[model samples]
Target: MAPGTILLVDDEENILQSLSRALKLEGYKVETSQNGSDALNLLKNQPIELMMIDVKMPQMNGLEVLSQAIKMHPDLPVIMMSGHGTIETAVKATRLGAYDFVEKPLTTEKLLLTIDNALRFKKLQDENKDLKDQIRERFHMIGKSKCMLELYDKILKIAPTSGRVFIFGENGTGKELVARAIHNNSTRKNRLFCKINCAAVPKELIESELFGHEKGSFTGASKTRKGKFEIADQGTLFLDEIGDMHLEMQAKLLRVLQEGEFERVGSSETTRIDVRIIVATNKNIRQEIEKGNFREDLYYRLNVIPFIVPSLRDHADDVPLLVEHFLKIVTSENGKQPMVASDKAIEILKQYQWPGNIRELKNIIERIVILFDSPNIDENHIIQVLPLDGHIKKTRFEGKKPLRDILRDVEKEVILLQLQRNNWHISQTAKDLALERSHLYKKMKQYNIDRGNNSY
Candidate 1:
């Protein structure tokens, strides 16, 4: 490592020579100046890590020089030296950002220790800043709730290993965010983090998408293409909506998980790869397996490490923090002034059920922030901006209907509203209502809603 540079400023020639020799002998690059003006001038051109300045000087005094040096190099540590140093003077120097103050006839050992501590503090500050930047760049998991803290702790513990994580949550509950967090904090952070939406791909193309395809494999196959598994080799492959995958695809995926080898479509050549798999689904995999929609073997293999993400409704206490975070993000992006929510608005938000979880809350906050003209968002503003169902008008009557029936009615209404808003696209509507597609289909059938006429 390169030696740390130290600048010593004093009006006395003997003091400068003695300190310079001592510091040089201690393996530090030393520079000396007789006055504050010379020290400031040298500071502009020299890369000094620390400065020791005398409080009493002829031209520019030590305090003024310390102030100027801090403005030029904020991270540089300044230690004040004074023969007639008073308590008030030391306090004032500290207020002006001096790292430390030493009285006249300073002991070399104490001075060296102070310098070493200052350098270490600076290094720690730099490292913390870097970590914050990296966190901002990757996941937007915005929450300060106890649940979020626990989730963060889990990520720290599991990210360093080659564990196959099964993330379970409601739709839009940030399963992908959890997966990405694991990948970002893992040993393969530098490699690709690929995602495949199992429900979005057609049944016929699912095999080609997962295990690659040779040239002329099908009508549109003009050239060889790598699948998500190969693309995410040595990294993380996130299988989202895994419960929606076809039965045949599940069998093929099971084989890959068991053997770690696969043959491309229309090709006999088998390839092997080492991949860390992370599967996420809103659907209950055990239930799906019981229903014969999902493979039991695959479910067992992927359920090695299960992480359950809490819904926004479960952590209602964090709504205000999440609202503030979303408001700031939206206002900054739109170049608008900051806005605050009124107490009534907060109460209204807390009263409503957030079926869509964090993603829904974020979208609703952004919508309100963009449309409302008032600086203070009140209950009226929230009522007008959000959809009608956001504010429930009826209270439960136990004697009139069964609790389960009433709950089903409420769920059916919320699902219908979300379906209408999303133009009845099953996948999108399911996401907006925080339900799996199969679950939504079953609910629609139960409610006698026609999917053909309401199709997106």
Candidate 2:
């Protein structure tokens, strides 16, 4: 197969003919244009992997064509050639985005080498662009509910500022996603985005982990190291679960935020940094402050721009969209053809309380995609994958609630789920749950389940 298509533009017919023969003999498909106008037409009409243009052409000079071509396809690789080549002209071409400049009476060997290098560079550039697109897709938020739209607007307004952000939400509600969206849109986006989970890290080592440490600062301190703050200088540092941080460490962190500097463990030398701080927690920070678990001053300092990420249950209307998004992603990852959820399946998924929120939804979708071999997932598939009985442990099992109340809550959830699955047809729901029609009606009345939201 031909390696790639090459476009050669020159005013001289003989030069074009000779160059075309040389490139074709080396397994390249070549197109020749006698002037800049014809060359541009080729570029516009078809894909040209690379181009070699003479700098001195009639009507329109090679430089003019090069400029316009760059505008049309900014990443196109172009080489400038001229029998009357000058250092000044070569510099101008290079500055105009020419891949490389070659002089006329070009040696076949050198010409081939230049073309090879340019093709390799072009491949690398294309790969880099693809990788960035993949990253953006991976972190892309999928929702169109009113709450999500409002949150998106808030993120856009807050991203350009350098203010400290405090994001609050339940676990699995994507609080870290909010932080990431802010950092990716901020002025420091091109820099590092360092993150550390305050709750996951040990209290004894939290200080060193944040501020780094000097060699011999303590046992296992083998070498001098920089902390998240130092490494994230001029970027953004995400402190996840900041409410769980020790009070002493919170004081130290408060000082760093105030003075913009800190000393490494076992050293008194202060190191200053310019980092954007974004903190996230699933706990109620105000309650933490009132209970004396978190610092009130630090809470006020970091809460300059507060964000609340709504839990999945609050935006149940977006569940169908989220299901489709996860289905495509999971199927693609597993090298399988894309699958879709049936309407009934989606309805059952939406009715779920999602105590674990979006994270749980994604996990269940992945499990379904892997275990089931169907192109369309129906309600039975979801019922098989979801642990419907125990899915409410997180939402209904708070220690303060009595056992009787907890059982009652779980019973209500199960009955409601069954009702939704049966499309609120009371008889069908009663049969599915093996309950008498009168008993089901009594339970519905006790739980306030009504036909207002669904047809009976």
Candidate 3:
């Protein structure tokens, strides 16, 4: 295969021929353009990795072509060459975004070296851009609603401290994401982030999982093991589903929280740890404490820094963004081309109650990408997946409410549905709903709708 594609642009035929031979000899595919105008045409029509344009050309100068090309592909690499080279010309080329400046009477060796350097720099730039994109995907929270913005502010505030945090949310509301954001922003980001699901582990083995156990401590204890606390020493430990931890284990955990130390299952050797604990639970801790299933003292300690991750329904305006993000990720991971979610499909999604939250949204996207053959996922696809018995439409006619109250609910539903379908464009929504813009704004405030985000 050719090393890369290069476009050689110069008014001189002899210079073009020599340069083309040199590049092709080094296994590079070369395209020749006699003038800067043709060079710009090639750049717009095909993929050219690097371009070498003579500083002095007819109709269009090298600097003019460089400026236009950079505007089209800001990351592209371009070099300028001149036989009548001067210091002023080199500086002008640099300001015009030329990758390098090469004097005419080009030596084969020097020419190849400049090309190699330009390609290497471009590759490095592309790699850095991809790395930044991946970091954003991993750490950036995905919602733009009022609640999510508040949650982001809280994470930023708590991330630098060593305070114990208690995150409360419904299932699949991205609580783990909050915990990760906290750890990623903290000083101990380079250290371990240990997590264990309290509800998933058996009751008898929970202690061994949290605090280490010695060899032969129990029937299945074949070897000495380090628990999550030890592994996460000087790091962050995420306790998922903290409400399911046994009442007996809660006391032991409380002792560790208070003393910053714990003993192995079979050994009296106490180990001290400097772990920042961030625990999450879908259940209400107060209710758990009232039932005598959780320690009130432990609850108070963990609740020092409280966070609530809003459910998907609470921020329905964010549904379109979440849907598009999830679809791109799912389709790419499965080695398939990305599919589009139509506006009507997004409206249907925004109407959903999403008991399972973001997790359910992701699953639904992946399923559609796998099962549907069409590139455009429409409202019918969403309707097929969503449950028929839902609350939004169901709550409208409940309890034989008064006529005025029923009309208010109906108006709120109609306005919200229109706003969502328009991706929160206020003027367009009002026009589509046949309401004046001022009246629409008044109704939005009366219904307490804050059109703060989701501008698409």
Candidate 4:
């Protein structure tokens, strides 16, 4: 596909033909107009990536078009050209957001260079804007409850500091989101916010993953690698599920926290890094330390500034806001029109024990938005969409076709919920459910329970 469309406006037909041919040959889509009125019409009708307007045009000069275009498309890049160019006119065009001013004897090389630079600048502006939006969306703590307000106060107090934070909550209570909120609001916001799951990485590889590896470090180590600590240097490193890390890895991690240095795997040289540490776990730190699953020293080191994300039940009043927020996002992403959840539906959503917390709520909302095509979401629709927890066991029996069919659905849902709670770790899920790995695999296949790219 062409990179972008460039609109060329000039009273001179020769200039229009020449520029259009040049831009198109360079793999750009080009549109041409001989008058400012036609150029304005095209700008209003179609998306133009970059526009070149002749300043000395008949009927509505480039300056006038540029001024009006700024109101219509504030971010659009427009370059002005004039054979009768002047310092005053150039200054005026620049003030009106013209990308650049060019003389009418437009050099192909100079014009192309200006266009390239302007486009690149605009792209950077757009990317920065997008990053800001994502930061806002990812860290938005959607609640106005007193507890949430208190949590926000704490986040605002600690985010700008260089303190290490230890966040604890039940699974899916938005620990990761809390970590991101800290990073997004911190002094290191412009730098990287690297994350790694202590439970996700293999026991043997967790060290190399944190401290990096030299070429030929171990089996399949074909290239030198920079670990999360190095990549997140001068930024933040989030250690998720920190309680699940092996005891041996805990010692090495403690050393990094104390000394801020570690040698790469299979390399003698040590490297020092500056990273703000943020660790999170669903496990109780004191209990884990007593049981020898986690290190007491490491626990103390990470708990410099502790944060406990509130469970969804603790702030049930936020359900309406969260429902609205997720519904808007879900529908817009799915190319659907806005849908409103009834007030009673919101009240019913508040009555649930959200064991899986915000993540679970988001998944439930996404499923409902996709499955239910109706514009209005009522209590009946919500009761059907909510999880079949033991609280609503009778609801599951409603309108059942057959006893065997209901058992199959219950089996599938129970297994799926277990897998989701365990983050889709098949072995652990099977072990917890008291099933052999082989049996678990057979059942999963029978029920079409695919872990890959499947959301709970």
TM-score of each: 0.58, 0.73, 0.60, 0.64
**Candidate 2 residues 1-456, lDDT tens each?**
238999999999999999999999999999999988889999999999999999998899999999999998999999999999999999999999999999879889998999999999999999988987787787778899999999999999999999999999999998887888998888998788899999999999999999999999999999999999999999999999999999999999999999999999999999999999999999988899889999999999999999999999899899999999888889999998889988878877887789899999999999998998999998768866877664453645767989999889878878876776566789998998999999999998998888663221
The local distance difference test score of model 4 is 0.87
**RMSD list, candidates in order:** 15.9, 6.7, 15.2, 12.9
For candidate 3, give the lDDT.
0.87
Q: Rate the local accuracy (lDDT) of all candidates.
A: 0.85, 0.90, 0.87, 0.87
Can you rank all candidates by lDDT, best first? 2, 3, 4, 1
Q: The CA-based lDDT of model 1 is what?
A: 0.85
Give the distance in Å from residue 242's predicted Cα in candidate 1 to where it truly belongs: 0.1
lDDT tens per residue, model 4, 247-295: 9999999999999899999999989999999999998889988887888
Candidate that would win on TM-score:
2
Clashing pairs in 4: none
Ranking by TM-score: 2, 4, 3, 1
lDDT of 3 at 144: 89
Better-scoring candidate (TM-score), 2 or 4: 2
lDDT by residue for model 3 over 1-456, one digit each (tens)?
A: 238999999999988999999899999999999987888999999999999988888788888988998999999999989989999989988987999998879899999999999999999998988986696595567888998899888999989999999999999999999998999889998787889999999999999999989999999899999999999999999999999999999999999999999998999998999999999999988988899999999999899899989988889899888888888888888888879999978887787778788898888898888888788998657655655445255446779799899988777866766675565789998998899999999989888886553221
Model 2's lDDT to the true fold? 0.90
Error of 3 at 73 (Å): 27
Cα error of candidate 1 at position 63, Å: 43
Which tens-of-lDDT digit does each residue in 1-456 have in candidate 1? 345999999999999988888789889999999988889899999888889999999988999999999999987889999999999999999999998999988778887787788778777877877876665554568777899999999999999999899999998889999999999899998788899999999999989999999999998999999999899999999999999999988889999999999999999999998899999999988888889999888888998889999987777778898788778878877788898898768876776677788888878888887787677887656665666565442444346788888888677656755665465678997887778899999999988776443311
